[model samples]
Target: MTLVSTATLLQDAYARGTGVAALNVITLEQAEGTVLGAEQAGLPVILQVSENAAKFHLDDPGPLAAALAVLARTSQVDVSLHLDHVTRTTLLHRAAECGFSSVMFDAGPLPYEENVATTREAAWWGHEHGLLVEAELGYVGGKASQVESAHGDGVRTDPDQAREYVAETGVDALAVAVGSKHAMTTAEAELDLDLVARLREAVSVPLVLHGSSGVPQPTIAAAIRAGITKVNIGTITTIAFTRPIRQKLADLPALNDPRQYLEPARTSVSAVVAEMVATVGLAGTQRS
Candidate 1:
């Protein structure tokens, strides 16, 4: 298994009628863990770095992107490096130049016409560089650049607008808002299945479900059945990574070495990723 295009992963999932797991990677450890998780589960995965994570690394994600690219190349399972929820043209270009296989150009918060214009430009440029481009049609209720709000605040993606936006942007994938919120610690978000099915029937491109960390496992599988080909997950994996580290540090107060704790935390994250990959029906899949 070698590094593949993000489009390849999602397209394979769509062909197989399953969903691909896209996890956010914030650190070198997280990248390693994600690749290992996919390997352990024998699934193809998208390892993504969000705009916020890039800024956390001082807006220069070259080092992290390079690291993930290397891991993707060396990993035993199919992996892709992706830049998620990036709005700034400068950052978007930087990510493409840094060897990311794809990028999510978020313009969901912009006015309908402006979003189409900006996203279309990004899609054109991204394609020229042989990178897969994904754009959200409507807001998904999250942080800035991703969705521009928190808790979704009752913003839903209109099926008609979704059709028009996809036709206008020409993105490789379209993230639609049904009824999920970002950063939910609990898996209690109720999805509008009817709306999801309608959008699936209306939009030609593959659909992405944002704020998936809040959706229940069963509901995630249901979303996939209803036409969600890519599921973006973050908070839950971070929580899984952190919870173990907290426990380790509390149990051993004199843990001066970072590896002693981070190793276990990384393993925890890997297990979580593997579980999600299985839940999405991608485990043991070799199409990507």
Candidate 2:
């Protein structure tokens, strides 16, 4: 299959009432594994590269973006590249040039008015370049500190505000804070399905659930049923990839070759991706 547009994929999911898996990729192995897993499940997936991941590659995302583009073009399953959680305007502008089909302009940390202004500008640029733009409404806390509430009582996205924001910003998708937190190591987050349904009814675009790594499989399915069209998963894949490598190193201290451990790590990530696809009820489903 060739590289596909994220908007097209998400629109299909939205119309079908299914959620699309948007898996994060920080390395070549992760990208390959994501594609492999999607192929295994016969599903379409979005391969995401976050701003943090770009910074990890010496603050230059071109090489990794190019690599992901190649992987997407050669993959057995339909794959789309998404630039996730991008706060910098430069990075947002580089999305189309970097082979990205969509970008999440993360101005959620900013005050509401400022967030609206910045996101609107981003959405305009993205549309001009034929890229889907996704923006967040509130801070889905968890990456900075685990102790913080995943669903900050007053920080959850209000359905009324979300409708206004989507109207004002003209974003193609909206990521709302229901009850999931980022960087969570456990799958115990309970989502506000009512809020999800409300947001879905309020917004004109597709709904995205970030911090989904912490959401249980059943809850994830429920969220999809309630209205989540895109699910962002990262931490779980990291855990899966690292656990096998840690065990492999502990069992064989003499294994000095990177490939020896990374192969299993990659396979582990693939398993996680495939499982997530199934959880979202996309496994074995054909992409339109």
Candidate 3:
């Protein structure tokens, strides 16, 4: 299959009441593993490159983006590239040229008016280039700081405000703070399913769930049923990819070759992706 657009995938999922797995990609192996896992499940997947991940690769996303583009173009199942949590306008501007079909312009932490202004401009530019633009509404905490209680702290998005924000920003998707926190190693976050349903009814576009790695599989499925169209998973994938490598290194201290460990790590990622796809009820939902 050829590389597809994220808007197309999300629209289909939104209409079908299913969720699409948008797994974070930090390396070539991770990107390959994502596609392999989606192919294994016969479902479409989005390869998301975060702003931090782009900075990791020498502050330029072009090389990694190019590799992902090639991988998606040749993949067995439908695949879309997305730039996730991009705070810089420059990066948003460069997203289409980098072969990304969608971008999440994160301005949620800023003042409400500022977030609206920036996101609106980003959506306008993204539309001009045929890119699916996504933006965060409420602050989904815990990526850079200590994990906050998912249900407390006024972090959850307001349904009424979300409706206005979407209309004001014209974004294609909205990432809301339900209960999950970023970088959580444990799957204990309890989502507010009622809020999810309310937000779904509040906005016309698809709703995105960030920090989904912290939510249990059953809960994820329930959230999807409640109206989460896109699920952004990162921490668990990194944990899965890193644990095996650590174990291998501990078992073979003198192993100098990278492939010996990276191969198993990639396999771990593939397994996680497959499980996540099933969790989202997207298994065997491949499109022609």
Q: Each candidate: what lDDT?
A: 0.86, 0.88, 0.89
**TM-score-better candidate, 1 vs 3:** 3
Can you list the residue pairs that collide in candidate 1?
none
In TM-score terms, candidate 2 sits at 0.95
Error of 3 at 92 (Å): 1.0
The deviation in Å at residue 24 for candidate 3 is 0.2
Cα displacement (Å) at residue 139, model 1 = 1.9
Show model 2 residue runs off by greater than 4 Å.
Answer: 145-147, 283-288
What is the lDDT for 62 in model 1?
A: 92
RMSD (Cα, Å) of model 2: 2.5
Minimum summed lDDT over a 10-residue window in model 1 is located at 279-288
Kindly list the per-residue Cα lDDT of model 3 for residues 131-218, writing each as its tens digit. 9999998877686632356566767899999999999999999999988888889999899999999999999999999998889988
Better of 1 and 3 by lDDT: 3
Ranking of predictions according to lDDT: 3, 2, 1
